[model samples]
Target: MYKILEKEDIAPGEKLYVLDAPDIARKAKPGQFVIIIIDEKGERIPLTIADFNREKGTITIIVQEVGKSTMQLGNIKKGEGILNVVGPLGIPTHIEKYGTVVCVGGGVGIACIYPIARGMKEAGNRVISILGARTKDFIFWEDKIKTVSDEFYITTDDGSSGKKGFVSDQLKDIIDNKEKIDLVMTIGPAIMMKVVSETTRPFNIKTVVSLNSIMVDGTGMCGSCRVEVDGKTKFACVDGPDFDAHKVNFNLLNDRQKVYLKEEKEAHKKCRLEERISGNK
Candidate 1:
């Protein structure tokens, strides 16, 4: 059993858990993720490695309670033990001195992008970060990102704080100013990354996006996280959760996710029903 060292609600519907995984934390890297199951009968859920403390042997995971699995996870608290937590999976972010790099994050994806931005900074790259949310309350980690980034831009649709626009709007402004952006790493809603990639196409800027496609085993055999890049099939679990954004076909990916929605919802409902029935018996 993997013990939960700490857990807390960070934002509305978003919870953070720090687990006692000594081996995984020791080998964890900036862009990797983990596949966790709350119990033996629980469904597999993939979560980004939000943060890690190597010395302390802990890995942090930020989860948004969007579905049943996460709702169940939120019911638990610190010091509890998870049935299974396997990780340090997927390829780590390729770090190098890539000139000026723009790290983009949308909503809770900001947690995933923070480590990569910090790593880029350590590699002597000028890091510019662009973060956005539907509203200000949903945003988090401003100071952590800003500390590592040379330039930071924040955007929200409602303009409750930051600029009154989308993060894509900020990207256009940066390009308009003729700033040299060597690499762009984005993580967020699939559609948002699609727009970011489209925005940079005219300038031929190199952009990479992390795919959170449907994943089960989080190993190559499942083939659940397949993505089309450069007209070829690649598995996200083993091949990459990160790929060249310019070559990815977002339309296909969006369609696949929709196809499974109804079944996923039914599965979630079934799990909840069974738990309720057992509680009464």
Candidate 2:
């Protein structure tokens, strides 16, 4: 059992958990993820590795309370143990001195993009970061991301914070200004990533996106996380959670994400009802 070392409610529906997983932490890299099970009967869910402390043997995961499993995970306190924590999974982001790199994050994807931006800066790349959320309340890690970025911008759908626009808009501005962008890495909702990819495609900017497909197992055997990249099938679990944004079929990826929507809502509803009953008792 992997023990929870700490828990913090970072945003309205987002919780960050630091777990004691020495092996995984030792091997963890930016752009990889973990499959966690809250309990024996719990379903496996993949969460990107948000941060890691190698010396402390801990890995941090930021989760938004969007489904039954994540809600259950939020109820778990520090010192409690998780049934399973399988990871350091997926290919790590290719880090190099790729000149000026733009890292874009939307909503919870901000958490996923943090470490990668830091890594890029460390590799001597000029990191420009753009963070976005629906509102100010959903945003987190502004200071953390800023520390690594040479330049940073924030946007919100509502004018609650930063500019009243999307991350794609900010990116477009940077592109239009003729900034020399060597590579662009984005992690966010599929729609947001799609827009960012489209924004860069015309200029032929090297763009990468992290795909959050429907993944069952952390291995390729399950075939649940297969995505079409460059018109070829690739499994997100083993092949990558990262791929060339231009070559990815965003339509298929977005459609596949909806496969469990109805069942997910039902599960969340049942879990909520059970929690209320338990609270009453």
For all predicted structures, in order, the TM-scores are 0.96, 0.98
Q: Which pairs of residues have clashing backbones in candidate 2?
A: none
Clashing residue pairs in all predictions, respectively, total 0, 0
lDDT of 1 by residue, 1-281 (tens): 89999987777889889999999999999999999999878989999999999999999999998877888888787888889988889999999999999999999899999999999999999999999999988888899899999999999999987999989999999999999989999999999999999999989999999998889899899788888999999998888899999999899899877877998799778767877987831
Model 1 stretches with alpha carbons more than 4 Å out? 271-281
Task: Give the number of the best model, judged by lDDT.
Answer: 2
lDDT of 2 at 153: 95
How many angstroms is residue 263 displaced in model 1 relative to the true structure, after the best TM-score fit?
A: 1.8
